[model samples]
Target chain A: MIGRQSILEADVDTTGINSLRNGPDDNGRFGIFGGRFVAETLMPLILDLEAHYRAAQKDPAFKAELNDLSVHYAGRPSPLYFAERLTKHLGGAQVWFKREELNHTGSHKINNCLGQILLAKRMGKTRVIAETGAGQHGVATATVCAKFELPCTIFMGATDVERQMPNVLRMKMLGAEVRPVTAGAGTLKDAMNEALRDWVTNVDSTYYLIGTAAGPHPYPEMVRDFQSVIGSEIKSQFAEAQGKLPDAVVACVGGGSNAIGTFHAFLDDADVKLYGAEAGGHGVDVENGHAASMTGGRPGVLHGNRTYLLQDKDGQILEGHSISAGLDYPGVGPEHAFLHDSKRVTYAPITDDEALEAFQLCTRLEGIIPALESAHGLAQLMKVAPTMGKDQSIVLCLSGRGDKDVESVGKYLGLL
Target chain B: MTTRIDTRFAALKAEGRPALVTYVMAGDPDLATGQAILEALPQAGADIIELGMPFSDPMADGVAIQLAGQRSLAAGQTLRGVLGMVEDFRRKDETTPIVLMGYYNPVYSFGVEAFVKAAKAAGADGLIIVDLPPEEDEELCLPAMAAGLNFIRLTTPTTDDKRLPAVLKNSSGFVYYVSMTGVTGAVIKSRGAVGEAVDRIKSHTNLPVAVGFGIKTAEDAAEIGKHADGIVVGSVLVDAVARSLKDGKATDQTVGAVRDLVAEIFSGVKRARG
Candidate 1:
């Protein structure tokens, strides 16, 4: 039981406006969690990249270019559809899905990719690179690179490359090179290491399009700004659909880009609750079996930012296990850590078996196959929505499509 | 509290020759073999010793050093055992500077303040924390400096004029100029460009500058010695240790082969003008 202040009472912006969204401060600290913890070799480039991002944030032309691509290329303003069958089945809260799974490249990842690819072009970078776990982010990046006519590379763990081979083929088909990282358990963390190595080596020509809302400063900040469009759209869409904000907003937390996007706009609304569901693999009670950073890990720095990390007493990061590859990361974003500490956001662990159950249930109930990453959020919704009144409404961020995860789920359930 | 790093650099300046800095992963192949290599380093003509604290995931490392660390970990080399190697080496040769080079996680997990105290007590001269940058000086760099241990900073090609001062601010004893942008082990091919970068760094700091990354042969060391105050060798030495092993155990020639290579590299530094 990690105790935190009741954010419902604390840090309330009385003006019905968001102050949490305006964070982090100039040093990129969301309450001492996010900061640039890189090597001296990469510091200048990071600083330079930060400067470019800051200037781009103010330039209307940059905004125009990115906004244009988001609408026409990636299909912006993904719909807010009321899940009638799901609501009826839950028999408690009214359910609506801010359908990010409908977006191009089949997830909310393209929202960030389009924003970053525009920035890369403005910076005159010729090549782009990124790391992926489930291959959603890699495909998004590869798609944007193909459209922008820039060469692209994606670093994926050897294990992921084999399991998510279809997405690997998708990236190669989209004219991007896919490199398999064979380090540390062959997962997301190892791929991130290889990507950073590539970024250091090719700093002059390559712009690293980080897929998550974690990493060194400017990244966590900027990626949030990019993905904030999700929340920004929901604010208006929910008002049009429900005539007001939903009672609660729920999203799955991996590296926490989608969750941040879902919760960023409603941060100032004290009436609306926010929930984040993290992967609890076998169980967090066992040593190194899960990815529930907030509930099961301690604060430490990794891959640039200080956040809750699943590491050993020796400070070595323990590899996270999840039936969903996208959520199989040992660390969460720094802002999520701040929210967890402040109690503005409630975080819970969703076990693999529970998520699998929700994955099947959502498909049958709503006729929508959800990505296993989003199934964690659905699992949490299944647990909590039944406890709420029928008049209350909850919005679940259906973060990605299930196509990339179908084979893995098939193998897991012995359906293959 | 004068650090051995400062003393060695000063002595090398007086000698008008570049210092030979050797890096070998502690507990590589096994603890006993790693200890033998450490004991033989100074006698093999190495002026400064860099003992790599073996880590499970060395992000900044290349294949050679990565394999060496794995070898050490497979032999059950914990952070304490690696530090003990430094303490054991101090018992015999206290003059040769020993810098513990590795990532920040092990020390962070060990607790920064406690790690610094133990490192100082163990006779470790300095640190080259690859992960913590100038922005995170509060994390480990400043504390290590206050404990009478030198915090050496690594400068690279991308470290521009604007960033050089910050990199050099808390840096003492020596500045490490990484010869390339990539991970360690990939050799620096452009000798002239590296020489100019070393000279550029010398213009900013009075502290000696040691150059590393890709100086594999004696010729490579002598050429880099023309520009640097110290020549640091890591990956090749680690690779030597890896190749000398048979079935994961150190063969009879493991320690001797590394010592012979270090002597040859040292002779190259000796041949170069100060």
Candidate 2:
């Protein structure tokens, strides 16, 4: 078991966002690593976003509307609770949980989906297309598009469609078309492929609501910027709670949206520790199940931008496995690539067994069941919290509630 | 004659006609048929031959080329296998320059040093990695040059003056000017823009510049040939192979279609030269 004392004693710096704003394209892509790599058909739409996002950041009307929505609809200022019981039980450092679960849709995914859907409306796009695994992103997309009266198509892998039937139905009820993509491995990556094909076929009328901070240029940067609210909120929330930022910020990385969102605000904060928890299925071996791209992959181009990927000797993409459907992808976001290369963040992996153990522990101790994807981050709390004294603080982003994962957990526990 | 690519441009300039380049995916339909198409290209008025090494995912390519890649991969075509084809061709013909074209991952997987050495040893005169640009030169360009193999650079409409010089610096054999702003197999109605793009690139480098991406028909090739040093057609030929397969006569149809396009393009080049 990992200790928590080390996490609290870690330093917290908050200068990453300031540097990002000052960098190229007002986001941090050094060169070929970052740019908008959308098709020519969507160039005008993205350009509109480039203009609106710049304006919205400065516009009081936009800020006020977003603030109002966050407060009333999505439940703004999510609590920062000290995990005293967890810390004491683990016999380690102090731990604090940044409760993103309290948000309306019960996950950090809503933060991005809601923001992008609104941007889509502003851009005069009436239809939205999204890809999902575990149906978290699809549900979120369906939820937001419903609220906005925008038509949506959610592409889910046939495998995920079978596993996440409840969320699939929820998306259907929310009035979004649930497209079960049967190609490839019938997983998140396949869903993304189908979504891209749809976007290419319907580029004129549909807005591709990319679920994470991955894909080609502009998307990784754009999605990160939209999701950066998590980091920005955490900075002030942690400050108010502990009279300073937490020593470390830890979040799970699937396609890395949630991690990047939570990590971006602290990039330049040289003192603050940043940890990206990757899905370690069984182990790090190629054939062994794991989505530890940063740990196991080489620098290669995939999707749009050059990033790490699980590929064979011939550079053919290898299937990635993880208990969490969301984290079972071979490639990671490009910014994570930049961060890994620049040594700005530490990327590590948590095994499926470890995450499941953490999932059960958190549910038993706190009466809060976390999505398996978010459990990866909670698992890190056990690893990092035990090394420091009680004075140091560790903040773990609880990205989603686990209600959607009850059936899977039941089966895993042999209670189904 | 000078060893520099510019000297080849000078030679083509005295002829006062554009070079007619032909592109065919290696192992498309089957290895034997793809090889046969390659061998027959020079006789069909092809000045430079661009042979594609298939990849599973070709982001820059259209459906026609993508299908060709699928067929090639299904036939178990490897980079080594394609290089072997080049060796076989070199035994009989060596005057016409052969450029191996494909995505970067295969080469990266093959190990840059090993791939460069193998390509040079196999009698491959040049390489055209569609996805690799100046940004990724460290991966293959430097090693390829060290092995005495030409690294052809692709300059798209997006390649501005600011970025052109870097593209030209690392480039060898020739510069492949993508005629359109989209993927391969797209058709452009106007050649005026392509001519202007060729002129823009000419102002930057004196290398033999071949224009491709949307050159579908002979007229399109001829129009582009007026401005470019070489007119390259890809999708039209791949489409021919696809048509052949659909017709259940891929062997005869693919070769015959390529022959027809080559004759038309050659006639255009001859008219320009005269």
Candidate 3:
């Protein structure tokens, strides 16, 4: 009973700060996580970026331009559909899917990409660079670069390029020069290292459009601000559709942009429980086998910020494994670290098998195929929904469409 | 309170010649060969040494240093192992200043206070953490300086006059002026621009300014040394170690190869003012 009371008290604002969304205080720190941990070469530029972003936030013209593009270009107000069959089959809580996959470029990645590319244009940056894992962010960034008439380069691990060839082809078709990095395990970490190398070399002309909600200070904050549209829309649509807030909201967390975005709005509503699903490749208990940073990692600095990372005793970052390349990184976003520590959000590891099962179940039951990244969230929902009462409701962010993952999923399932 | 870095730089200032600073990854290829490489530097004409504390991810470095770090990690070099190498090098020589250079994660993971105490006891004179800027001085820089270790900061071409003070505020030992806006092992776009940047940095700080990044050979060292207080070289020497390795293991020529390059580059530093 004492433990249950403590869990109830966790909702109280212990920091005396009013809102959970008011994080990454001036130093880019969210309760000792997230800071500008980049090299001195990129420091001044980062400060300059923060200044521009602050001004852009204040300017009405900037908001109008972003809003205009959101509706007319990238398809804002992505549909919120109640999953009738999935809910009935689970026989407990009602399930609702936030349709981010139906958006342009087939994922929530475009939300951040569109905002960043607009900022790049405003900064007069002639070239763009980004690192990607599953190629969703890469394809989204390449899509924006083509629309903006800027030359862009996408650095991807050789392994990711091999596994995600469909996205590789899509990026190439969108006119991005995809540079395959062969360093380390040839994964997202190596790709990020290569992209940083390129950004440092071409600082004067290039803009690094970070794909995730991690990285240095302004990037985490800026990316979250761009992605907040997800939660904002969910708030209104859910209110109108059900006449009340859902009991819980869940999303898949990689570097955690989509989760942070979806979690940002409901954070102040203490009654609304927020959940995030992490990639548990084999299992969190197995060494070097999972991407569940919050579940299995400790606080360490990597990729320009302090976050939970899968590293060894010697502080060497371990290359994490996941069926979904998007969630294969060793670290999670700093905000998620803060949220996890603050107990405002519950993050659980969903194994690859569970996610695969949920993937097939959602496809068969709802007639909607979700990205493997999103399948992790559905797996979490499968666990939580059955435990809740029939009157309760849950919203799961279907972060991307599974089109790009078809071949990989097919191979894994022996259908190839 | 004077560190070996300060003493060595002051001594070279009196000698009217820029110091030759050589860099090598600690425990690169293997521990024994890396120790031999460190021991040979002073005699090979290196006035100061920057021992690379290899990390899993060296983001600011180019391909050569990156591969060298991989080779070092593969050979099982831990942060503790790097400190042991420093202790071993101090057994024979004490005048050549050693600055441990790398990113901040390994040191942060080693426990900042304990690592500082261990590093000072290990006879390391200074630090050159590439990721830690002035904003993060509270993390390691101030603590290190308080414990009598010089915390060197790197100033790139992009660090403008307005931002130079904050960078130089907690800076001691020296200001490492990156000659260009790029990672290690790159070709310098203009030699003349490096001289100007060095002069600009000299105008702000009394600390000896050493220029690094993109400096590959003796001739390049000579030209850059004419304007700066010291010349720093790393990737090319690491590349020499790489080229000498046969099937990823160090050969007999491994130590000799780096010594030969250091001797040649020192020759250039010697003739810069002449």
Judged by DockQ, which candidate is best?
3
Compose the digit string of candidate 2's lDDT tens values, residues B1-274. Answer: 1232344456677878888778899988788888888888889888778899887666567778877887887787888899999999989986777889987777877888888888888888788886665655676788888888788888766666776797789887788887765678877756888888888988988677888888776667666777788888888888878887853335567777777777777887766545
Instruction: Please give, for residues A1-416, the per-residue lDDT of candidate 2 as tens digits.
Output: 11101111122332243364323344325443554433333344455556765555555565566667777888876888887788788786677788888888788788777667766876688799999988888988999999999899998989888877788889999999999977557788778866766665554578889888887545776677667778877888888777787788889998999898888778778888888899988988648378888888876666655678887667766668888888988888887877888788888889989999999999988888998998999887778877766777778889888888889878988998
Flag regions of model 2 displaced more than 4 Å.
A1-52, A121-127, A178-183, A193-206, A268-271, A286-288, A342-344, A388-392, A411-416, B1-23, B27-37, B40-48, B62-84, B107-274
What would the per-residue lDDT of candidate 3 be over residues B172-201, giving only the tens digit for each residue?
Answer: 999999988888999899999999999999
Off by over 4 Å in 3: A1-16
Predicted chain B of candidate 3, TM-score versus the true chain B: 0.99
**Collision count for each candidate, in order:** 1, 26, 0
Residue pairs in candidate 3 whose N, alpha carbon or C atoms collide under 3 angstroms: none
Return the TM-score for each candidate structure: 0.96, 0.76, 0.97
Q: What is the C-alpha lDDT of each candidate?
A: 0.88, 0.77, 0.92
lDDT of 2: 0.77
Q: Which ten contiguous residues of candidate 3 chain B have the minimum total lDDT? A: B178-187
**TM-score of chain A taken by itself, candidate 2:** 0.91
Candidate maximizing lDDT: 3
User: Model 1, range A297-399, lDDT digits (tens) per residue?
Assistant: 9888789888998887777778888878889899999999999998999999999999999999988888899999999999999988989999999999999
Give the clashing residue pairs of candidate 1, or none.
Answer: B187-B214
